[model samples]
Target: MDDLIVKTVTKLIIPFIQLYGIFVILHGHLSPGGGFAGGAIIGASFILLTLAFGIEYTKSILSAKVTERVEIGGVIWYIFIGLIGIAISGVFLGNRVAGFPMGTFGSVISGGMISLITIGIGLKVASTMISLFHHIIEED
Candidate 1:
């Protein structure tokens, strides 16, 4: 972890990895990858950071409190979105029937609530991964 090359590489690559993860989460409705995949990618970046830097440094960036909040917030957001569907269409994740505007075909906003759902899932997964990793490290 004291290697200069690793630290430099991690610092440079983490942003791009996170960006790609966001892209996957956003475009999941239109493409193959979805929230889980995107979240895993982002989580891997954090893990890499922990490896290159240290647990204390990683904790400084993403404290336990913040990670817990993000994990809870992701679930709450997902549930809120589902509730919107139920309120509108009497179904838990009703998309078109919920009166959500489906954008033009093959576009980013074309999947109605799907994109939103994936966003929540992505956040949850990423935060969960980070939390789990930290916990494991602490145990060791």
Candidate 2:
């Protein structure tokens, strides 16, 4: 952790790793990876940062309170989106029937609520992972 090389490498690559994670989350509907996979990727990056920089430094960047809020927000957003479907068509997560624009085929916006749902899932998963990691580390 005190190694200059490790800190430098982590600082250099963290952004790229996080960016890739976001890409996976956003393109999940069109590709093989989805919310869970993308979230794991992002979580791993944070874990890597913790390993390189120590828990105190990591906490300064992403406090436990913020992580908790993000986790709760993700679930709430997902439920809210589901409620939208029910309100529109009496079906939870109803896409087409809910009157959401389908957009062009094979496009980012084509999946309607599916993409939104995945985004919520991704955030929830990532925040949960970070929170668990912090708790486990603090227990030591």
Index of the highest-TM-score prediction: 2
For residues 1-140, write the lDDT of model 2, one tens digit per residue.
Answer: 59999999999999999999999999999999999999999999999999999999999999999999999999999989889999999999789999888889898888788888889999999999999998998876
Candidate 1 residue runs with Cα over 4 Å from true position: none
Clashes of each: 0, 0
Tell me each candidate's TM-score. 0.95, 0.97
lDDT of each: 0.94, 0.93
Q: Cα deviation in Å at residue 84, candidate 2? A: 0.5
Q: Which ten residues in a row have the lowest lDDT in candidate 2?
A: 107-116
Q: Which residue pairs of candidate 1 clash?
A: none
Over all chains combined, what TM-score does candidate 1 have? Answer: 0.95
